[model samples]
Target: MADSEDSTTPPAVSWRAILRGTGALPPAKKTGGAPSDPALQLWRNWQANHTQVVALTRQWQRIETQLIHSVGFPQVTIRLSGEEEPKIAHSVDEIEELLADEPEAERETLIAAFDAQQKRWDEAAATLGFDAVDAELRAALDKESDFTASVPTTKAASLPGIAAKLSIVIQLGEPSPKDTEFPWPELRSALADLARLASPEAAISPL
Candidate 1:
């Protein structure tokens, strides 16, 4: 009976799956703040413009995941060059294996679609200020004397790069990183400052 029940359990939904299932999911709960609140307004603004970036990001993620698996390289990166071939690195054997999974024509079509989608994603990210949010957060962090003192130089340098990742993770409704990898408490404190100090028109970028 236990085995039967276990076998019947559904697989967990990923963040990307949730994006795809947005229309089918229950309405999101309202977390109210005063009408004049900057963070609240910014959150609303993000909700409005994030659809394109989110969709493109999800699509690229799927392509990247498939390419990585087919190439037998977990960290393989994929990008499109203007009027040039897509940047995907693999040996002849790996390419052959990738081709075996999907016909050459279908694979080329997929890559072309991804290239167009990625350009749109880039435009949306720029217009929506995803990188700007990272800058805002990093700028806020730099002002904290105690935070600066506590964070090591190497970690401090990497914070800007990871700031966009942090934003994206939040947007995806993913769990926060463990304290061992990132100081969650410190991040929360910095966020508090960011909310309190940010201007009314502050740009809150997403991943």
Candidate 2:
């Protein structure tokens, strides 16, 4: 006969299954500068605003997560440009496959396209001394469906007289480079202002 202890034993829980369970997730703890101190509270507000500004730099949150994968960031489901509300890349190929139909010039064009949008975002926010999308590009949805806006000039003046229309697509094993410049001048200014305030906490903590 089998032992009663063996019969009553529960199956072991694999780490994978434990991770899969969201029901046991712990709640986020809300902790920041002291509630009694207005100066510390103001600094905390600046810090929170900084996070919002950074999110705009990505143009979309999912794309942001994909660009920098880490814990605390959820596993974002990347979908192609479709009727879906959110889209990171036009086609799956844009992310990895088509590898960016290019001549060195075409690659530069693509990078420049995104750079211009970044320029618009940065210069606008800097002038206002506040982060906002103003008359244009304020709505993330406006940007989400704009695949062409994200694409750079089809061809730069890499070759003297060849029109891009006449050019042939070149396939390379490597992926096209992205516009790597995401500036945070507004955030920097806020931090600088906080530094100038020279509060005791500000002096002790540099962010």
**The candidate that achieves the highest lDDT relative to the unseen native structure:** 1
Tens-digit per-residue lDDT, 1-207, candidate 2: 222321211112211111121111111122363233232222233323334444665544443343234222211223334446543433234434323533555545444554554555455445543344332235443433242232233332211101111111100111221212332333333333332342223232212
Note the Cα lDDT for every prediction shown: 0.37, 0.30
> In candidate 1, which residue ranges exceed 4 Å CA deviation?
1-100, 138-207
lDDT score at residue 184, model 2, on the 0-100 scale:
32
Counting clashing residue pairs in each candidate, in order, gives: 0, 1
Provide the global lDDT of candidate 2 against the true structure: 0.30
Q: What is the lDDT of residue 174 in candidate 2?
A: 12
Cα displacement (Å) at residue 195, model 2:
42
Instruction: Return the lDDT, model 1, position 54.
Output: 52
> 38 in model 1: Cα distance from truth in Å?
32
